[model samples]
Target: MPLHKVIYLSNNAKLYLWKITEDFDALFNQIRLKDSSLARLQTMKSENHKKGFLAVRMLLQHNDYNDFDLYYDAFGKPHIKPQGCSIKDVEISISHSNDFSAIVISEQKVGLDVEQIKEKALKIASRFMDVSHLENLSKEEQIKKATVVWGIKESIFKIKNEKGISFPNHIFEDDFNFEDKKATATLKFNNKEEKFKIQFDSEEDYIFVCAFESIKN
Candidate 1:
């Protein structure tokens, strides 16, 4: 319904996930219509657009039902500004699947992604799975292992604000026991090494996994 989960990674970095169950028409009415035709075309994409608009309403605390003036950068990232809010240096990422739309906000540049793990071809895992890492797991453990690895790579891409990074090569996972419900990923980017902690939880029939950059000294 509201603030399903709040993850605090550091003093300045955190994430907020909200579950939307409101009617699409009410959600659409909350968005301000722009004169530009392109803006109108964008809104027609799906009901998710309306949900995203409503989800953001809680963030700005606006009640007039006016659409907040928001835009994305050349790289397709959402940007927001509050009239009287003093907090700057905040970054956010929004994702929606099924009946849930999540918004992750942080003071540092951050990326957040949630995937519903599905059955896929095993060969696809080779693209992202490290040879050494795969050798250690048996046939059944491979799927869960690969899913966690893929999530780590995706989160890193969001953190780096770029794509085209090889999963298994650029991102590697250390010895982890998924049975413990927590794992860690070691990633190399820009010639620097960073570590990300991955946490997995079961929501209904879905496995929700998230990765966040560890606080640096």
Candidate 2:
């Protein structure tokens, strides 16, 4: 389908979401990929994976940017450098799950992650989050909360984009109600402590997260 949604996190940041309802031919024909991107697409083993990849590029085109304007760094963090010399200082992050793909572009550093709510998140909750926060909730609620916490850490890690950052040990989510739909977290790594302001919401059965560096930093 067309761009599923767009959200403004701040005056300088905007998020776009795409729901994959089309097959590979439909997406592949809509955009032109630079050689590298085309090569990467051909290597994807899953039909869903290839479709998600194309959906991201389709979202880029919706914003008046195209595949040629995007690139990645050594750490595999996606970056945007729009064609021509008119644009600069644009930061981009991309993520996709089973049926949705999302990207966030900002003048400030940002990170994004979208994961479908599933029991697996709860099963591995102790491996990456503070499980005590999951108390006092039904099994269903526990899964939803666990998914948010996982997205919280993943989003923060994307912002840092540094190696050796462990979710359970280095990233901590402050106590907050899942109903709040927003939260704050601290990333303690490299002898420094960094904070993030996070906003999250549900789309269909998936949870999408956006994390920004705390202005107080």
Candidate 3:
């Protein structure tokens, strides 16, 4: 198991990235899975998704947890049951892109998304992002920026995990320069609004974005 990188986002939040170098059997043999998780893994249509799923369990194990401590809700959001002796609650988000799988664990409300850089993201930018933000930049820069913006929207959605949150209509990302590597977004849904603090960075050919609900909310 090659643990690619570990990022400490804040005092209570940390992110882990795993480069999927093991074969399916290798990964499968290493982690313990619950019955429901085993059934769910069997339904995954692609080996990449299975590898990503198993790799996430590897990450959980690295953090002293296993599949038994994890669960999902009706919305398909992942959660962790803290050890009985521990005082802090745990929040987690998971994402995978190509040969990489990543997870973010936090004591605060958090969301995370990782995306591979692709021209398609630029082509569909108008559907989910403010196109003007990509203006005056080179084509490659536009793709990177557009992908980051998409990731920003996804991260915010994961944090809120509420119904009727459309990426284009409900999530609004503030203007940001690519060099900053971080930004903020507002999720306006239902009849109220909340703000999120966002941080993003690139690794290899992928963009990783993490969101934390603003304390001011």
Candidate 4:
């Protein structure tokens, strides 16, 4: 029960994070998986992935939902099915990093991503983000900021779940100070534009970001 942390973003949305401190068998014994999920788990090549997958189910159980309520779309996005006719649809987004797995649920469409902070993100920041944003920052700060930007793009991509969306060309994040911990971004794709509200934070050595579509007036 390494439920690391929980963030209540809004009345209708929240984020759940699990720190992977349990072994595979311990996690697997605590939750039941569907045939498809079991098959998928068996196919995973790494033990860490299996543990991450199981940890997600444990989170679902913590939230009172189970594997039976979850499904995936053609684009491979994960979702949850309302249990009854009176129940409202719940939007879900899942992400996993080195030692953490997270899920965000909301009445509105949402996207989430968790990534381990690393120098690689800084080295490749220019390809997907504005390099100017990294100037005037220490090397460590640069890595943190770049990782956040990358997470921002990835979260937006999860929300859209569309094809032909390039991180640099299609997604644009507004400039903000590192202290903000939140920002806005736009996705211009398929001849249309949409806006997103982003929230991010650093936990241990990883960064987790959540995105929600901006409400239109």
Instruction: Provide C-alpha RMSD values for all models, in order.
Output: 4.2, 1.3, 1.0, 1.0
Q: TM-score each candidate.
A: 0.70, 0.96, 0.97, 0.97
lDDT of 2 by residue, 119-141 (tens): 99999999999999998999999
Candidate 3 stretches greater than 4 Å from native: none
Collision pairs in model 1: none
Q: Supply the global lDDT for candidate 1.
A: 0.60
TM-score attained by model 2? 0.96
lDDT of 1 by residue, 1-217 (tens): 4456666656865555556677766654545544552365465667776566566554333322223445567877766554365656556665555655555656665556665555452357777766456677776576666666666667667666655566766788776675776677777766878887766554543444556777788
lDDT digits (tens) for residues 41-107 of candidate 4: 9999999999999999999989888998889989899999875674788899999886999999899
Off by over 4 Å in 4: 83-85
179: Cα error in model 1, Å: 4.8
Q: Can you tell me which runs of candidate 2 are displaced by over 4 Å?
A: 82-88
- Write the residue-wise lDDT of candidate 3 on 1-217 in tens digits: 6788999899999999999999999999999999999999999999999999999999999989999999999999999989779878999999998788999999998999999999999999999988999989999999999999999999998877887889999999999998998898898889789888999988999999999999972
**Per-structure clash totals for the candidates:** 0, 0, 0, 0
Residue 215's lDDT within candidate 4 is 100
Extract clashing residue pairs from model 2.
none
